[model samples]
Target chain A: MKISARNQIKGTIKSVTKGQTTSHIQLEVNGTIITASITNEAVDDLNLKPGQNAYAVIKASDVMIAVD
Target chain B: MKISARNQIKGTIKSVTKGQTTSHIQLEVNGTIITASITNEAVDDLNLKPGQNAYAVIKASDVMIAVD
Candidate 1:
């Protein structure tokens, strides 16, 4: 499917932490680990698992950074 | 400073919504809007405002995607 996000990093699933409403998903991209929070229903729909290839689609607005 | 995250998208601040503890920041990247939830403290620390150049740094572990 087509997504509007600018950064789509290709990675493999490392882990999946399912919560009551939200699910924490971990992806490994080039030795770096990325984590995302999603809904449990979405997890069931996607059937995400370890070793599977997925893309981390990041929108410029969804990322928060701090500078000193 | 170098961060552990993999995805760093450059964009301009579109808006900032402050709440009790968390703040939502919207950024425009390449014509696409990206929204992020951050702490109010981080907002003040960074001095975020509209029209400022900021980056959306996403860790691979933080991005969750679903495919149908």
Candidate 2:
């Protein structure tokens, strides 16, 4: 599948936490644990599991640097 | 439409630069310029233009904080 985002980091799924309407997905990328909050359907569609290889697609605009 | 990923931020389209296969999208969120590198098709499909309001939908898994 083709996507628009530029940052696609390859990693392995570390954990999946399902909530009522959303789910938190954790992946280990170069020893960095990145968490993703997505919908249950996304989890079901992607069939995300531990040890599975996945790409983290991020749009630069979506990234917000916290300012103090 | 409902999306799965979390970390959605509202902003205005600042500019759109189209390349051969990709495009660079810039957005102003709370006076901060956030950039997004997406596909040219995504830009066309989304009709992203300056002064337009858009949402930066980010999946947490894709977010990686740089550390020293």
Candidate 3:
């Protein structure tokens, strides 16, 4: 995926705070906090949270996931 | 804040599609698509999406907003 965000940092998942509806995803990218509020379902689906080394991929276009 | 990602670009808001729980925020950063899934209330509170020129700020650390 091609992203065009001016600030892209590589970070690790420090924590994943779960809320009723949304979850706070904390990425420790370069000693900075890059948080993304996403749905609980997505969290479960992605199996995300702390200790999972992944890319905080941000795209310039509207986010759409194609399961193919 | 200091981020440690290798990539970063500038972009504009292209569109915002509202979902039941999460909203798809489309950002046109340097002709690329950077979509962020945020809460509907955040979308309303920020009054974000389309035509609004803002920064797609991504930090390496877990994202935390300090309300001062």
Q: Pick the candidate with the highest lDDT.
A: 2
State candidate 3's DockQ. Answer: 0.09
By the TM-score metric, which is better: model 1 or model 3? 1
Candidate 2 CAPRI level? incorrect
Which digits, one per residue and each the tens of the lDDT, describe model 2 over residues B1-68?
23345567889999999999878889899999989878787888667789988877667566899988
Report model 3's TM-score to 2 decimal places. Answer: 0.41
C-alpha RMSD in Å of predicted model 3 compared with the true structure: 12.4
* Span of ten consecutive residues with least summed lDDT in model 1 chain A: A59-68
Which digits, one per residue and each the tens of the lDDT, describe model 2 over residues A1-68?
Answer: 33345467889999999999788889899999988778787888767888888877666566779978
True contacts kept of each: 0.49, 0.30, 0.08
Collision pairs in model 2:
A35-B61, A36-B61, A61-B35
TM-score of each: 0.55, 0.52, 0.41
The DockQ values of the predictions, listed in order, are: 0.27, 0.17, 0.09
Q: Native contact fraction of candidate 3?
A: 0.08
